[model samples]
Target: MTTGRGLRGTAAVVGIGNPRYHKRGTSEDSALALILKAILAACEDAGADPRGIDGFVSYANDLNEGLAVGAALGVREVRWSTMVWGGGGGGVAAAVNAAAAAVATGQAECVAVYRGITEADDGRQSYGKGHFPPLLTAHGIVTPAQICALRTQRMLEADGVPRSAMEALTAVSYLHAQSNPDAAAFGKPLDPEVYADSRWIAEPLRLYDCSRENDGAGALLVVPAERARDFAQPPAYVLSGVQGAGPDWSESLENDAAYTSAGFHPALVNRMWDGAGIKAGEVDVVQVYENFTGPAVASLIDVGLCPPGVAAGEFMTVDNLRAPGGGLPINTSGGNIADGFVHGIGLAVEAVRQIRGSSPNQVAGADVSLLLGGPMAPLVSATIFGSAATR
Candidate 1:
């Protein structure tokens, strides 16, 4: 959507880092401190000097300014900086897209795309209190769970996607989290009985269906693809980074055509796959943003990974979504639902790890990895990462 040769194999993620994750309000470090630590760690991972960082990109209304962070890190210069304008994790992939664009276009040689969250910080606002049209508020659709529930309900009833699909998706993330010590839900295994027994936050959206808020920061260092192999870590090439909303998607609750769909349009999905020169069946793993399980299910269908109708029930089984042997291993880092959510930046980092074959739940021969940002938001994004073989 940015319009050019596209990001396919133009830029590469050389390094990724994150601080120790904590539950909201429990982090000992400030947001700024966490972000700085993450960036420094990324630089170390890449075997690059911190002073080499010349650009910064972030999303979700991040408060850390580029020039300020540059100064803190003693960077040689701040050449470029930008933030994706939107709410929620929808812009996560967009932020990485911007960073890759900067590197590809030579606007800056090394860009660090990062996000930090200190939900307990003073003056922090509840996500549910976001400004909405009176039409939505008057109907008591204030919380995100209530808003997304409507779309999930429609998909189940109208599209005939079984509720078990949502259950399986939720179970998969928790299942993966059990193996990831960094996951907030680590050590807490989820079974179908436990998921079914959980209370509903909104009708059709159970407690396990939602993402957990955590305090942490995550970052990825992007450099030109030619410079990728110089790093210590295996580079994850930027195959494609796509972001946009569907036609007339601004109407939110009133848009009938886009109502039950994830924010990804058919044309957008086509662009991403085309730009990457791959298809849904070619992706070895996916790290779909699990802001809620239902929208994530819709995202999988919208991207052509799963069928649009009752076939999703059979395709989205726990065995089919798990790592190693699953047809489509997803959320290998546990996803936002179980992994620490620093506004979905962690998902991007996990995508890189999958490409590097360093993931705890590594998918064998994972040459192509996909990362889908938050669904059902005003704007959504999806990115594709690949190993050197794909380039």
Candidate 2:
């Protein structure tokens, strides 16, 4: 198999639509109606027709299939539809990558990639409940907070990272969110005092460290770069994208040698950079999947934004990342912790929005934006978007 580097520039994300996200059961529409609304929003952003779309891609364990979506959207014909394989945001970027490959390889055109979740209407998914499919209930390692807390504790002990580091990381997300009226954390500013006093959900992981379980849908419209201008918004070319794990794929929590691994940060750097044909330093904006605080910081390091062991001191400070131009602006749209999670699709839309110069918290001169999925699941992926002028 080729490196798939050729996938670069073959397609572009022309439109991204994220309607208001809400807490569970508050949404006015059913799950399917919410999805259709999101698709229509994306089409409006692209100035393209939903009926013109020939393919679709989605994650969240295929909660809704493409054919049904196509039928609902009144598409002319869906020649193809593909599903990315993880149950949560871990497969978000990969779904976009898959759509790019589909368009590039002539499998389809005008592909709609999306994620529609009704956690609010129903209830929080597996993460909220103590459920880990791989590890039986006997281990007591069921929820995401529990698993990530283990990794964070290990890093603090093994790497000498300060407790303040994690707090700052958690704090910066809310700081950015405060500037975004679209964020769930918009009005609620997270100060050091609140962060310090917040109750601990898991050891080394405080209440603020966890992500919100919101009910919403997010979608993006993708088409060949050459034809993007024929549609609505300025095209953010799909410069490069990839999705993979560190080393172990099927390793269990108790038995794996790399069990303590907090996803694939240090590992995915070289590959993501090399595949994208751009150095990490060239990235103007970053939209990290902040499912929890620790993984987000580790993601910055793993993706090469900062060096190992220096993320906390060098990058986690509020003064550094709060606003654009001080340091790299991450999760400019508030991310999962603050933005409300629809798996990882919301983060991807924010990355595209940054490239379009339309994000709520805009990053200055952002020609290249890196969007990461949940690598902390240890099975993750990412995509890099570039402005139209970028090669």
Candidate 3:
């Protein structure tokens, strides 16, 4: 149960599975079905039987499915089952929590973490309730896009972030999406002109600035590091993980500019780097949450992966993220904006792929990856991953 800056005794991710994405199909696929499918595949990949699972983790009130999904996954015994209370980005925290809990307590040898969500016709309604605090609801901060757009407009004015910056990032995401087979908006990539003229979802945020609502599921199987060599995929050891929460929704506190940035706490970024025993420069690939383009750019700067205010110029370059030999290869599997928002679950799976050299637009010799989990209700999670033996 020893834990420290290094992953000396931490659990490792042994298998990852994502059920096939059906862009337009509305057949009888339920959240439980998708969850089971992903779990079965992940277990098979890890060479572990479902009955061996003793721990489970998922969202508290995930819209796609109910809380009963954990027990229904066929785990013969249960040591722990609890939901991490955050928004879309809670998925990564769930995995980290499960792994840490399993390693700390003598509860289980194997832990299965899974997330399944669907963008069916009724999916849009899921966001309208329970996601925000009383103040946000009272102040009419309804849809997530509107809430983020307000922040983006303020950043645009204060930081002088331009329309071109938005267009460039969104357009690059679309281009990457077009290259991904699982992307919901694959053939619907948008151009700058089209993006500029598109109807606004909220001021300063056009239709293209938001992530696609997608229906998909992702799962990760973790086992004690000592047993990782017997699993399926070359394990991606969890080097470090940290989660942080911001101030409450009070008038001056939540809206204060200085404290506003605190909500997304750059502190977690430092902790992630410190815990991994590596600076941001050592990161080979980055899987940033793309709920909105502004936060995606802001995360790099906040995390010290890029110099302050230079993310738009350095990493946002189309040639940089997609070039044959670019400086930084980001979201090569198409980020959340392009890869289908499996609610940050897709990002973790993508990170594992990059480290394993299985990604479609794989970065050359990428043995390390950085994954960020959200623009949640003032909570953020960051984690570092590397080959299991490194643990």
- Residue 77 miss distance in model 2 (angstroms): 0.8
For residues 114-209, what per-residue lDDT tens digits would candidate 2 score against the true structure? 887785444666433322664544677767777778877876787656666667767777878888898998999877888888999998888888
What would the per-residue lDDT of candidate 1 be over residues 277-379, giving only the tens digit for each residue? Answer: 8888999999998888999999999999999889999999989999988999989889988887778888999999999988878999999999999688877
Q: Ten residues in a row with the worst lDDT in model 1? A: 122-131
Worst 10 residues of 2 by lDDT: 126-135
Best by TM-score, which number? 1
| Model 3's TM-score against the true structure | 0.89
| TM-score comparison, 2 vs 3, better candidate | 2
Best first by lDDT, ranked: 1, 2, 3
Look at candidate 1 and tell me the lDDT of residue 102.
Answer: 96
**TM-score list, all predictions:** 0.96, 0.93, 0.89
Candidate achieving higher lDDT, 1 or 3: 1
Each model's C-alpha lDDT?
Answer: 0.87, 0.77, 0.67
Q: Residue 177 lDDT in model 1?
A: 90
